[model samples]
Target: MVETSKVVVFQVGNEEYAIPIRFVISIEKVEGITPIPHLPDYMNGIFKVRGELIPVIDFERVLYQRPSNINELTKIIVIHTNELSLGVIVKDAKEIIDIPPEKIKQLGLIAYGKTSYFTGVANLDSRIITLIDPLKMVQSLDGIKQIQDFMAAEVNT
Candidate 1:
C-alpha cells in the first residue's frame, strides 16, 4: 500500500501548489516586514512573529516571476525546515487535503527544470497541483547568509 500525505494548499499567481503539512508550523498575517539589504530579491524581508524573527520569501516572485505585491490577500505560511524556520508569502492559502502517493508523479526533467521549486505533481479531480519541498527551497537559495548579516546589522545599527 502506498502512503499518503496531507498537504496544505496555497496559491501563487494563478497556479495552485501544495506543501506537506508536516513542515507547516503556522499561518498568520504579518503587519510589518523590515527590508534587508544585500539579500536576494526573492527574500521579501524579516518579520517579527510571536516574538521571533523569521525571514519571509516571496513565492510568487521566485516561482512565477511575478512582482511581489502585498495586499489583503497576502498571508505568511510558516515552514519549519532543517536549516531554518522561514515564512513563505503567498497571495492566498486554501484548505488542506490528503494526497495519496499514487496520485503523485515524478515530473520529467524538463518539467522540473521549468518549475524546479516543485518536488512533484499531484493530480486531483483532473487537476494537477505542484508539490513543493520547503527544505530544498530554503536551502537552495544563495543569499541566506547575506540576509542574516543584514538582519544583524539592522539590529546593531
Candidate 2:
C-alpha cells in the first residue's frame, strides 16, 4: 500500500507555503488579540477559542523577520502538536492539496537554508510548494518557553 499525504496551502507576505494537514486543527478569522507585556515581537498575543487560550504567532515575522500586514484576508490557523496548541496568522489560505508520496521531493541544502520552515518540497504542475514542518517552526520561537511558563502560571493563579 502507498501512503499519501495532504498539505494545507496558505500565503504569507508574497510567498506561498504549506503545512501538513495533520498538524492543523482548523482555520478561522483572526480575533481576540490580547497583547502580553515583555513578550517577543513574533508572538502576536493570545486569543480565547473554545474556552482555551491559544497563542497567536505572526507567521510572516517568524519566517521573514518582518511584520505581517493585516488585511481582510488575514486568518488564524489552529495547530496542535503533542505538547502545545497554538494559532498562526497568515495572509490567506489557498487550498488543501493531496500529494502522493512519490510527488514529494527532499529539498536540497541550498533551498533548505532559504526556507528553513519547510521540511521538504512538493511538486505539482511544475510549481513547488514548500512543506513547513510545524514542530521545527514552533521550536524556533525564542519565547516559547516563556509562553509555556505563562500558561502554567495562569492555570495555577
Candidate 3:
C-alpha cells in the first residue's frame, strides 16, 4: 500500500505553503481581531467563531520575521492540533491538493531557517509547496494565558 496526504495550500506573501488537511478546521476571511497586550507582535490576538474564541497568530511573523501582508487575498486559516485551535494569518487561502509520500521531500535547515516551520517540500507538477508542521508552527509558551485573561475580563466587565 502507498501513503498519500491531502494538504491545504495557502499563500504567505509570494510563497505558497501547505499543511496536512487533517489539522485544518476551516479557512475564514479576515474580518477583525481583538488585540491583547504584553504578547509578541506575532501573536495577532483572538477572534470568535460560533461563540468559540481562537487565538490568531501572525504566521508570517513567526516564519519570515515580518508581519503578515494584508490584501484582498488574505485569510485566516483555522487549524487544530494537540487539542488546541489556532488561527493562522496568510496572504491567501488557496486550495486543497493531494500529494503522495514519494512527492514529499525533507528540507534542509539552510533552505529555510534554523527553526523552520515546515517539515517537508511537496514537489507538485505545477508548483512547489512547503508542507508545514502544525505542531511546530506555533509555540504555546507564553502570552496564551494573557489572551485568556483578557477575554475573561471582558466578559465580566
> Global lDDT of each model?
0.81, 0.83, 0.80
Could you tally the backbone clashes for each prediction? 0, 0, 0
Q: How close is candidate 1 to the true structure, as a TM-score?
A: 0.85
1 against 2, candidate with superior TM-score: 2
Between prediction 2 and prediction 3, which has the larger TM-score?
2
Error of 3 at 24 (Å): 0.4
> After superposing candidate 1, which stretches have Cα over 4 Å from the reference?
110-117, 148-157
Q: How high is each candidate's TM-score?
A: 0.85, 0.90, 0.83
Ranking by lDDT: 2, 1, 3
- Residues 57-101, model 3: lDDT tens digits: 887887678998677888999998773678999998889988899
List model 1 lDDT by residue over 1-157, tens digit each.
Answer: 7678899998888788999999999998856888866678888778887777888889887876676577888789999877778889998888899999889887775255445667889988877899988877775676877765665665676
lDDT (10s digit) by residue, model 2, range 28-110: 88877899888889888888878888888899998789988888899999999865888999999889988898888887752
The ten-residue window of minimal lDDT in model 2 covers: 109-118
Model 1, poorest ten-residue lDDT window?
Answer: 109-118
> What overall lDDT, based on C-alpha atoms, would model 3 receive against the true structure?
0.80
- What is candidate 3's CA lDDT for residue 134? 85
All-Cα superposition RMSD per candidate: 2.7, 2.1, 3.2
